[model samples]
Target: MKWLLQLVLTLSVTFCFTTAQNPEAAGRASSWIGGAEHEGALRALKWLEEAQDLGDGGGGWGSDAPRALLALQLSNCSWIPNAGMKAELAATKLELQIALLLWRHHEPPISPGRLAQYTLALGAMCKDPRDFHGHDLISLLLRHEPESDFEFAFVTLAVCNSGSHARKRHIRRLLDVTGDTDKHSADTLAMVVLALRCVAQEHRHRDLLRFVAPPALALAALQQADGSFGNLHTTALAMQALEGAGAIAWDRGAAMNLVLSSQAPDGSFGDTFTTTEVVLALQSRGLAQVSQCKCNKPRLPPSDTELGNFTFS
Candidate 1:
């Protein structure tokens, strides 16, 4: 009886561990894109193909989604060119329908440049978007001066989300091609570093991780002892990098402790974006919520003053 019980327990533990790591459990269907067999990729591919449109590139409508889907299919190990080609047409049709719907809702057409970029990037996955030749156009659009840093973050996500090593490599090349890092604004550097770290994690690229550490560390040093940072978004980016590097000294509780001490009485974090961030940081390190801190009130809400400053644009 004891021997039989042991076997059952061992199997149970094994099953639980496997289930916990099941790639299917991730929120995004594409989360396991490269990690899964071609059959699984096909399911996601079919869904996106059925949902995309080829015509409406304005205001988020267009071939981009389908392009991403088709690219994932091509990247899958199970794809055969003939069958994949057939599926690609259906996907493009789906995207075009979606674009039409979007056009109906638009007050004015989206910018031509934006439309071209979205389509071309999508097209690179399979057929090219009309007029735009390749992902290069998308990269160019992402390079717009005002908010290139933030824009690139999304573009990297688009390519990386496709789960193609080639796409990831292309994104890396885009980063390398940008030689203007010397003129980057503080916000720009933070966004770029955020994208770099995100791509690194997606591909388990250790070299990229190392490359992003210096700027992350510099940002970390900029944090006051109180855990408040100069810029809320940049601070979030820095913390994300530190967490990824395993260099935040979280076990010692230095960073978490500093954040806790700085949280205001109202449960609202400091005037900047520090409150929720500090709470989340503490949680990541296995600490309780700030409201549950033994020294504080039972509950508190983040203040409007703090919230307003960081309100989503």
Candidate 2:
């Protein structure tokens, strides 16, 4: 069974490379975001700001500090008007501190997903992932053996973003997983696309480009008639993945339309999590943007304004 899967993937990759060589067959992918999409993203950003937890020692939205911080960084919320900019930067700093705290003291072993999230968040904040508060987040991520394709993808992104070389075996694992299943959810496939793209960005891994296209093509195939790969959340992530992978085979305009249409009057897609992702996708930002982020350190709030003994299990 394993051998058959490998053979199938080998042939599929070969075919993808062959197709990619044809200019007409591999038509340029359309841009996913436009002026209207940018407007919608701003609205979603407003909604995220409104939904943030501003209680004492609170600067994050929801339980996922790393994700929230990454989302805000990607949105470049600091560019908002004067007071709004200050508040956004403060919130971002607090969120960063919260994420660091969680990383330092989370008991019962942090999962690869959470660690990867932290690593990406740190990168987005322009912090050193290799020496974050005495923790080498990149080393920690590399030490884990991802148990699923999701973990593999997350780990790959984190490792690559931290200016660390992802293990060749990790790339092989991603390719194998992408070939092993057609039943992968849009979220999983999208993540795979981003991860593979990260690997392809390095000159050393240029040879791995052939393996990158199959998963992207598979993700493109999952697009629904309404331009979504699934719901609003999955659609948002899928858009990012396709764009990041440079696989413009999907319907960019329709996908953006669906995303914009799903917005509530409050300028949100639904919840905080969904809103964050939708904002990132609408802005055409992905995990890869973390490495490119040029951030200014926001002035820390008073010592009394700390996270207040918050603990992560």
Q: For residues 1-313, could you state the per-residue lDDT of candidate 2 as single tens digits?
A: 3533554455455444433431211111223357888778767766665565454433446465556667766666333222243334443454344344454554677778877877787676676777754557677788888787777887888887777776656766787766864867778888887877776674245656666677788888889899989888888888888775664578988998888889999898877778878877877456766666555433222132222332211
Residues 220-244 of candidate 1 have per-residue lDDT tens digits of 5556665534454444444544555
TM-score of 2: 0.74
| Regions of candidate 1 where Cα sits further than 4 Å from its true position | 1-105, 108-147, 158-187, 204-206, 246-258, 261-313
The lDDT per prediction is: 0.39, 0.66
How many Å off is the CA of 266 in candidate 1?
A: 5.6
Clashes of 1: 9
For candidate 1, list the clashing residue pairs, or say none.
Answer: 52-94, 52-95, 53-95, 53-96, 54-95, 54-96, 56-61, 268-302, 269-275
RMSD of each: 21.2, 18.0
TM-score of 1: 0.37
Per-model TM-score, in order, reads: 0.37, 0.74
Q: Give RMSD (Å) of candidate 1 vs. truth.
A: 21.2
Clashes (backbone N, CA, C under 3 Å), per candidate, total 9, 0
Q: Which stretches of model 2 miss by more than 4 angstroms?
A: 1-32, 53-60, 77-106, 295-313
